[model samples]
Target: MKQKRDGGVAVTGTADKQPNAQLTSWFVRSGWSKGELARQVNRRARQLGAHHVSTDTSRVRRWLDGEQPREPIPRILSELFSERFGCVVPVEDLGLRSAQQPPSGGDIDLPWAGPQTVQLINEFSRSDLMLGRRGFLGASLALSAGPALLEPMQRWLVPTAAAPRPAAAQGPGAGGGRAARLSEQELQLLESTAAMFREWDSQCGGGLRRKAVVGQLHEVTDLLQEPHPEPVARRLYRVTADLAALAGWMSYDVGLQPIAQKYLVLALHAAKEAGDRPLGAFVLSSMSRQMIHLERPDDALELIHLAQYGSRDSAGAATQSMLYALEARAYANMGQVNKCHRAVRMAEDTFCDVRAGEEPAWIDFFTEAELHAENAHSYRDLAYVAGRSPTYASLAQPEMLQAVEGFRRDDVHQRAYALNLVGMGTVQLLMRDPAQAAHYTDQAMAVAKRVRSERVNTRIRKTTHAAVRDFGDVPEVIALAERLSEELPEVAEPA
Candidate 1:
């Protein structure tokens, strides 16, 4: 309704008249979908000291139908568009009334605000560099005991200390050194490098080229000490956080548990510095993943709960789906079949609601393949705990079969592909399909031999042992066991 009122000017009417073309044009230019635009509105509402504004896609649809929303929305949309488009988007732009003062956001109550983590990251990375240079952490050490890990989790959940100033400039890479003169090209290079590292880790597993990744991380950590333009600084921290998280995953993949913890802590700190809550939540999930791997499902549950609680109000549906799925894995590990089932159903439901453009770039990994892979795991655990009962076994089969096929299609994620093969093969064995089990097991062994991930190797070993112990009477199982022996002769789990 962009009808002009005063002096015969056109403006949008408050009635459901013609489509609100003016409002549509601006947001379309900003490249946000209806769901994403709705999320931004709700988030902006919270920042402006209002409760979640009960805004969603349907509300957005009504606004587009030339129906002006009540007070805060018009005001909120005006400012939100202004920020997004990097131009003054007055109420007249969207034909809305924004003639009120915007509420101020509440002060952050948590401790260690702003760039305080710069100091922490430098110290941790430097120490890592020194120790790693000497091969000190080359061998696995004991993982953080459950009680010892609680302190960090508590700080993340309820920080008490106020913000501390960043460290002095005399530190390495500080006081206008390499990072001080960072150019756009250099920043782009760093971003591309991080992306490349992720792709590499995906294709080849985390065991290969780990040292090169860590070496690059140390150099970039030093660059963090020097200040840069605001935009550059933000991107720097974001890339650094991504690198640290990837490093942690690689460490975990290689079975260096304690080292993985340090990298994860660094990732979490960097994410906080960047003010990227979603990335921070992802880091917490990674930490929970580590805990699950260690068989500490209670700790895993707590860590995932912290992730859920921290991002409950603002995280998109895709992220929530992943968090719920991770929660399901924790439940599965604890053998809480009902709780696991509930969490899995929630994950599946949330996933269905995820719009194409609602998820961020990093969430590109958690698609149908990943979800089905996780479900297969949850049901496999349940079946195991139920003594491989046909009931749960039947439930697991389709998911496992689907996930295996899905991973097979994405050959770039080598470890996932190999690991899911092992899983599907094991489930087949549980169903007493000796020939099918052997077929999948041999294929899994062949693919696993190409990946350098010790974690994958360890799990495949477990599958091998299970086959010998439970399906030994089957002739095909005996054949697959001999094949595994031939392929991984004298192989031992990583220290």
Candidate 2:
């Protein structure tokens, strides 16, 4: 039958029963209630390490009443059915395919040139501001991949330039706008504003000023549309790219993975246009960090390799040290202790070689404190791989203590202090000292309550989960359990 749908003419397949009918048939054959099926799907998704997959009985009931699921969920359901039925139950067969196509335009891919890069920054900033943080969680998996990710890392070796200087005679939106007359004063304003944003992010956590940063990015993107001399244009692109990267980093801090990926990709494009290979390499390192957090160490390694290949001759010693530190993280996660040690040595050697005033301003945060923190984390992971040995556990403690002291001296990044406490608590737990571990865990939770950061909160949750799991019989552990329920009501109760 032919019918009009969404103001367009449509054709229906004769074999296509109502989605509800097909869904009901499957439900009856599987002999599982809607709630049970939803629960099973959620359980499987979690096993697959997929985040933000929420399927409830009421949602399943709606699906069975002829409402099609949005993207990814349909795909997720197909996989679940295939596993249960021992056959290929495609998304099409399940009648759950969404009508909307995935995002394609807006420079979702890198190497975006000139005006397209400007368009992407503007579009992404607006979308991120409007959606806040939670809305992007749905397509976090899909947007994290695709050509957008692969092509950029593969091409980071080749430097690209921004658009040619438009004639001053050109009008608005025609290669040149009113910015042909831009002055050094205006450029300095942009740089200083970005620095302020970075400082705020470092001190208070990103959530407090995320929206304001987006507004700043929107203004910068508007400035990019104007025509300028080649030198001014290059400087503008670099400044705008830095702001965009900050936006992405803040989004990541708040646990918005998809939005972070989008902003970072666009930042890479802008950096490329600015002809700043080091900046582009830094952006690639950020992408690798995100990939590692997502538990894709292979992907993370690929990105680090690209950064190394591109920045080999150009990057300063400080930047080189940061890259090597990140590489150590990847190797550590993969349980390659030897390679991890080699990378750490290289990082230390390069860091010592850093000459004062030679390093770029952006690399300022990669201090000795940060290096020790990274090593501490790497050692902790290596300990797990080496049968949870007491040796690595002992090694992790001093580094963590050093990290804590550094963060405390700085007095800006309270979250880092809290994170180190969590690490110390974990080490204590592994050492079979439940009482001391509970004390550190309690301290971390108290500090975490003051920070508006999801990242810090996650670290606290992991430490508490460990406490509730291993030291449940202890009084301190019981107190921490009550604290978790009160502080993080949304988290599932420990098993």
Candidate 3:
């Protein structure tokens, strides 16, 4: 009763009901003989305590014919294939990537280049949900055409045209009353969101929860674009812009450099729309932090200059110190030792100039100990680039110790403190004192266990690995290494 199909293939009741030849091809390409793969899969299933094992080749063939594997089998199949191949075999190669690719422009009736605003919003939502799952890594989240699609989206978010003044500016008092009220509301929202994110960043690592922040930002951006009274809208725009900048920072924290860059550009536009010159400048400084991470010290310096220029009149002493300290870190990374020292001096001078009670709430996080720790970090970074110098060695010990003490206070600030301890442990390892390094690293790991932070754990592991390599035979160091190793999942090795 079957009819002959095109290409000389036999067809079943419907064209859609035909076997998925592509799946079979993938199995062959994966380098496993059909019988061998089936045997391995059965062994893995039995190991997982499956009550009954199907030894039939036909059952396995049906799975290759496009039937989805039952629970735990998919993971088992992945493990077997990966073990045999000696690399990660993505689920996609098993014909199980996603139900479908994102809609094409033609299908959605959107511009070929630019994503429709609505489509972009939906993608943000999807990315957030996908990213929130435990162990979800975005390293494999590649768009079909690479990152070029995001360029247009970034450009659209950052309008190149001259910003128009809000209609309220023409009103009798320039909508002062409404603007004030909106500003208060926006401030509350910003403070609340910032606190929540800061806590999460300390506990779960910015990498884990950052996508949700990005999603929330997209929602805020949509709200900003909606028609509203001018004053209120402008305030919302500014607040949303700051949130967007924070999202960019989180993206950078997780090593998503391209996406982070795009978000920063969009954040600049939003900041400008609200006439918050200082906030815009602060965002630019944050951009410099990403540039530093990317090892583009020259670019970081230029961005810092731009930030300083933009906020020259508006920035207070604390803000000035932060900007200078960040610039010093960049210079340190670049091996410009003298320039790094000079920038650190400038930061200290600026901090000294801040009168008691004159500091802004936004800059309250930068304390004396934090400043010194930053300087120590800059020195450590410089040592890595330029080889250890007497100057770096001298500054490393005292500053790191101070940082550790300050981080001991019970608060969200503990995250940064633990991070500094790990940094110090790295310096100790570099100094060839494995016992000392392990001591600090162990403390950092203890703090990391209490906090749900991926970033902290990542840093702690790096320090621990260095210590282990230097003193693998040292009993204390070996024990600490074993403990930390046991904490990570066997399948998910610590990076």
List TM-score per model, in order: 0.70, 0.79, 0.65
Report the C-alpha lDDT of model 1 over 1-495, residue by residue, as the tens digit. 354232121234544477788898887898889988887766655544456365778767767777656556775676577546433365567866543433221111122544555655565556656665433443222245355564565566554453433333233444443436677899989988987888788778888967667778877777766656556667888887888888889888886655787778777777767767788888889988887776678888888888898888878888999999999989987889899999999999999988997776667678788899888888887787788867777888899888888888885787888888888877887787867877887887888778888777777777777878877888887887787788876453221
Q: What is the RMSD, in Å, between candidate 3 and the native fold over all Cα?
A: 10.2
* lDDT (Cα, 0-100) at 141 in candidate 2: 32
8-65 per-residue lDDT for model 3 (tens digits): 2122333355465656776777777777766766655554445355544665675666
lDDT per model vs. reference: 0.72, 0.74, 0.63
Model 2: per-residue Cα lDDT at residue 264: 83
Q: Please identify model 3 stretches exceeding 4 Å from their true place.
A: 1-187, 355-361, 489-495
Between candidates 2 and 3, which one is better according to TM-score? Answer: 2
Note the residue pairs that clash in candidate 3: 203-452, 204-452, 205-453
Which residue runs of candidate 2 sit more than 4 Å off their true CA positions? Answer: 1-72, 75-107, 133-141, 146-148, 160-162, 169-179, 491-495
263-291: candidate 2 lDDT, tens digit per residue = 88888878877888888889889888887
Alpha carbon deviation, residue 255, candidate 3 (Å) = 3.9
